[model samples]
Target: MGKLIENKWFLLLIIALTWGSSFILIKKSLLVFTPYEIGAIRVGVSGLLMAYIGIPALRKMSKKVLFWVILAGFFGNFFPMFLFPLAQTQVSSSLAGILDSLVPVFVLTFGFLFFGIRSRWIQFIGAIIGFIGAGSLMYFSEANREESQLFYAFLVVLATACYAVNALIIKEKLQDIPSLQLSSAVFSVWMVPSFIILVLSGFFQNFEASTPTYEALGYLGILTIMGTAVAMILYYKLIQNTSPVFASTVTYLLPLVAVIWGLLDGERFTIWYMVGGILILIGIYLIGKNKKPKLLS
Candidate 1:
């Protein structure tokens, strides 16, 4: 038991479950609170939860990297925190999960555009194929070309793009900092703003109004603490202990988890979703694979 508990693979599985469960929690949270409130509470609570560990790093952090930390906090945590809830309002949790897989593609795109990172021909082709799957998802959903839902789907895509940029910032600028410290500091920086917005938005008043609100908030708390804080700590450790390719497999696992949960919860599932999801997964596989394929044990 102890050996499995300490295993990196075990830890990765836990992180995958926690993160993949987050969308359903978000859906539950939205039942009682506005998307803004949900986003605010999610970030604010996650920030505060990590602050204890972050304080040590906070004191020792160099000013040289503070700007990057702040930028990461905004693009990585702040924007996506709100964007997911807002986007989920219009898009199904399953579809959102499918689209979220596009992060690596956007990561490569933004990396190439802003950081001068070059990709092989296959990576470019993979990205194009992935976007076509995304298009199929949008065009074929039951909403059926409703501009508003499509707009929200675009928001989710934009949020993934935000995630891509955050990945670049972490790789380029904050690589030296320990992942825990960097994440803690980033969330800590944004904590104040999220709290301010949360308060101004009157979450407490709404929170006290009903039993169902408390139930939903409880789920949100789990999402904030387990999903954001603990999963991030484990993710950083996973990256440290394993190859990037191994750690990146979580990208493939998350959608499966999300889609399964969505199905159980009675969210719409369609044949197009299956087709689009397979294409996106294949595209991701091609993008991640090199000329020489590596075997796993």
Candidate 2:
């Protein structure tokens, strides 16, 4: 247990398993639930679960910090939660996961644009390259031949941009807070609203009427537990123990799991996907390799 706790590789594996599997879980949940319902349930259940265990950490946070937490919640957690499922309705989970791997690239791009942070030239070039790769993946895919479906794939890209913004906010504005505290507080602030949305969506009625709903809900439970709550805890620990770049390498592994799961689920795959995904991953690597600027004051 002690070695597992301290080993960076072990921590990385855990994150990859928890977060990487989340895309397919979203796919499974969407079998019965609407994107809005899935998003609300995710945030609501994870928020409650974290709050139950994270009370001590939450108490230590200042009220003044709640604003940033809420911002992160809405952008980083809430919006992406909704967007991924929505995108998956039209896009493959494999593609969604591949697009999600663009978060670090967007992080670099947004950081330099809005935060007045300086970045190396390679990072800028990488962002452009990453965009191109994403475009190719969306536009050229036989799996998403419909022009409208391709447009929906862009929604996943936009979600990554939101994730980038949230990452910057957390680093610059909420540096003093612990990871668990930040996650718990963000979820706590958003929890009630999300739950209210879920309830208003008439989820319970559908849930009772369908056996598949039970199986879908079971997948969602794992998604909430392993993907959101527990993964946040592990991610925070990784950040503490390693450089940000090292911790972010989980991005590289995520699509592999998503792609493998997609294949097993009988989703189509082609050499074109491999080409575009490689380019995006390369761009992400370059972005991470660039020296990071100081967190915003």
Best by lDDT: 2
Weakest lDDT window of 10 consecutive positions for candidate 2: 237-246
Question: Per-residue lDDT of 8-43 in model 1, one digit per residue for the tens?
Answer: 879878977988888899999888888888888877
Tens digits of per-residue lDDT for model 2, 217-243: 899999988888788767766655664
Name every residue pair that clashes in candidate 2. none
> Candidate 1 overall Cα lDDT vs. reference?
0.79
List lDDT for all candidates, in order: 0.79, 0.81
What candidate 2 gets wrong by more than 4 Å, as runs, is: 53-60, 240-246, 292-297
